[model samples]
Target: MAFIPLSVPNMAEKEQEYVLDAVSTGWVSSVGPYVERFEKGIASYINTPNAVACQSGTAGLHLSLIALGAEAGDLIMVPTLTFIAAVNPVRYISADPVFLDCDDSLCIDPKKLRSFCEECCYIKDGALFHKDTDRRIPVLVVVHVFGNMADMPEILKIAEEFHFKVLEDATEALGTKYLEGPLNGCMAGTMGHLGVYSFNGNKIITTGGGGMVVSQNAELLQKIKYLSTQAKNDELYFIHHEIGYNYRMTNVQAAIGVAQLERLETFIATKKENYKLYKELLEDIPNISIMPVVEGVRSNYWMYSVCFENSKVRDDAIKELDKDKIQTRPVWGLIHEQNPYINNITHNLEKANFYGSRILNIPCSSGLTIDDVKTVSASMHKLQL
Candidate 1:
């Protein structure tokens, strides 16, 4: 039997046609019609006024910080349970990151966030500064982990009071939406000051590898586009005002993105359908817990994950699955525990630490068939024995 991948890109003949068109037109570089079309499609889907295409999700996060004026020595708050891409941008700007804990849904806990601010930070010259580092804490990069929505109502309220910019790291949640409360009917990326989406090979969609940053602030979005494209003044011959980066996505990649976005809704529906089947199949397992979609929120179910009772059980199950030629992956190790970020400030991460050990991502590609789901489910059920 062929090994099932944990996640894989779903591309069809349409993607090939788009790539061929771009190649035939001889517009395979950055500046092309496909790039503009891709950016516009993303902006419309997210209900944002402006969107800027970039090379990757990391570029989007880094550009957001630069556009928001997050300078060196500044502090940014991020969830510790998220992929390192969400937190590395803070380091890119030479800014400090205070790792916050996750709640039941594996998102940044707003209550704990407020507690940390009130307890460990002090008001210096009317700015909230960390008491120990004395760095001005400026932004919160709220990641919607695995397509689950964070408690944005409480998070936005805290941001208003604390005066920190909110950058929604919706890299894994392109089609997710808040179905109730203040953010009801709002898309994941549009609810924050600036939002980012990733189109990596393993994401719900793929542009081969690309990302987009959207903002309600048109000027800021334009600035991000300028900075992404080496900050060159279009009118001048070779005039460059400030330091810039070559982070723009190529037309070939954008061509792929355009085709992928057209089928995003279908991909989202398939993922949700697969999650339901997984739940129904694994419902009887005693030691395993499937991730829950919080009430009134529609999750894309980007990567279907299960948590064993403990690390030992989770490890044992993984070994068993490997013997059966089934692919499985453990969740990210806590970022603060990593060698690079071991010295960073970390708040109480009881839930994050607990889940970090137990959670394992299973094969959840959009291309998965019912048989694939059944095979994986059978492997999971056998572990309960």
Candidate 2:
């Protein structure tokens, strides 16, 4: 049997066609038509007034921190249970990150966030400050883990009450959205003050390596665009007033992204089908369960995950599956546990610690066949016996 791989890109003929057109026109650099078209495509789909294309999701987050005025000695609230990229950008701006725990949905916990605010922080002159660090808390970075939408309604309320900005890391959840509540019909990245999406090879869509920042605040997005292009005050003559970055997405990458965006909904539907199939196949198995999305949210179903009874079982499954040529992986190590963030402040991380150990991501690639999923399920079932 062929290897049933993990999440990978699903490309179409349009990707090749657009990429060839971009190469033929000699407009393959950052300044070209495809870049603008890709930006517009994302903006229209997400219903945002402005979108700025950048090099990667990390770059998007870095630019967002800078645009939101995150400076040295400021504290940015972040979830400990996420890819390190989400928290590293806070350090890039010379700001300290205060790690928060995740709820059952594997996104930032709203209860802990509020409790920390009320118990560990104080509001002075309308600005929230950490009691121990005594640093200004300017923003909260919420990541929609594994395409599941975070509890934006609750998180936003906390942010409003504390007077801080919200930056949504929707890199893994491009198409996920709320189905009910005050955020009905609102997409994952569109609800926050600033939201970013990634077109990495493994995301719902692929641009090889690209990202975008979207917001209702057009002026802030314009400033991000300026900062991305090296912060040049004058194009005719080299002029620089502030440090900038070469974070713009190339037209070639954008060409691929435009093609990928056209098929995002179809890709999401395939993912949904595969996830349902996995659930049905493994439901009867003992000491194992599939993680679920939050209620009333339409997840992109980006990567299907299985939770074992414990870490040993999860690790043993990965080793056992490899013998059958089926690829699987454990969840990312808690970000706060990383060497650089060892001393960072944390609040009530019980759930994050619990889920981080036992969760194993399974194959849900859009191109995966039913037979492939069945083979993986069979192998997983045998592990429990």
Candidate 3:
């Protein structure tokens, strides 16, 4: 009977137990057992060899780029349709992002990606370079948009040919997996050179505000851990060999994370079931379509979205839904169009802009009951009349 909020954290687990333990033992800051336990636990879950805890997903991304040798004047390929945070790390490294478009799955388009690498870029001295700018494109930031996997096999093949590192932005796709192809059974984040996950309050699992950087490369992960903790060669002596950051995730947050990770599978199942119910409820609505998970991927259904015919229809639904105490929101605007990134070069963004105006994200928080879905669906159906 009350307004349904969009994507709130689910905390019916050992969150209290873990956080209380951390507080009672004076391990609430960035030091203590929970941080290492949380990092190791996440690495085990995702099948990566290592994981480093960090302050936020953006920090994880920045550290990953730095560890992987991102330099000034470098070009990193990113999807224009993704959240702005995914591209901001490129700027953090003094590198620029070349905006690529998304396909129907709302992830980076593999075909366009190939075309850009082969037709638009020229190879020299074993590096891929943009013909016009001559800047080396060494990394591709592929986001698993809304828990759906991009065409990673195709994307990986292209990356191998062009020699670019793949950094997966798995902040919204932690539980997703590829069910088919060369990467069959590979988790979304584990497939890339380095993958980053967010445990913000809105994620399937929450550490209040924290992130993890995972990789099969143990050495790379160690460097990230070093950088995350101020790059101290000797903690007792306070000797710093290189520039680092205070991006470590607090022990209290990691304690919460360890608890949250315990219930991740159940949360993912709830999300899948809720998404199915929404699909069934909204199927008959006119001039609207649901964004589907890709064919070979098992998505976590992190955020359920609907595409309307136009912005007017979407805005009308938002107004009607809110009036009925159901909160709904439009998808983020195209990142390239933002004020800070307006002048950046964007490849064929036809679909990005098309979905930008038409897509709406509906309530699908982990704790959402079937009754809540029914109420939200009924309110949304009213807009079709």
* Steric overlap count per candidate: 0, 0, 0
Candidate 2 lDDT, 1-385, residue by residue in tens: 6787887889889999999999999999998999999999999998998699999999999999999989988999999999999999999988889999999899998999999999999999988999987899989999999999999999999999998999999999999999999999999999888999998988889999999999999988998999999999998897988899999999999999999999989998988998999999999999999998789999999989898899998999999999898989899999999999999999988999999999999998889888898999999888953
Residue 186, model 2, lDDT? 97
Between candidates 1 and 2, the one scoring higher on lDDT is 2
- What is the per-residue lDDT of model 1 for residues 1-385, given as tens digits with 9 covering 90 to 100? 6788789889899999999999999999988999999999998987888689999999999999999889998989999999999999999999978899999889999989999988988776656789887889888999999999999999999888777889999999999998888888899988788999999999998898989999889988988988998888853687789788999999999999999999989988988999999999998999888989879999988988898889999988889999888889998988888888999899877899989999999999999998999999988887843
Error of 3 at 289 (Å): 1.5
Q: In candidate 3, what are the lDDT values of residues 1-385, reduced to their tens digit?
A: 6979988988864899889999999998998999999988998998888799999999999999999888989999999998899999999989999999889989999988998888789889988899989899989999998888899898889989988899999999999998888999999889888999999899888999999999999999999999998999999999999999999999999999999999989999998999999999999988887888889888989999999999998998888888888888788888999898998877877888888899999998989999999998888788863
| lDDT value, candidate 3, whole model | 0.91
TM-score of each prediction: 0.98, 0.99, 0.98
Candidates 2 and 3, the one with greater lDDT: 2
How does residue 178 of candidate 3 score in lDDT? 84
TM-score of 1: 0.98
Q: Which ten residues in a row have the lowest lDDT in candidate 3?
A: 376-385
User: Which residue window of length 10 is worst by lDDT in model 2?
Assistant: 1-10
Error of 2 at 329 (Å): 1.1
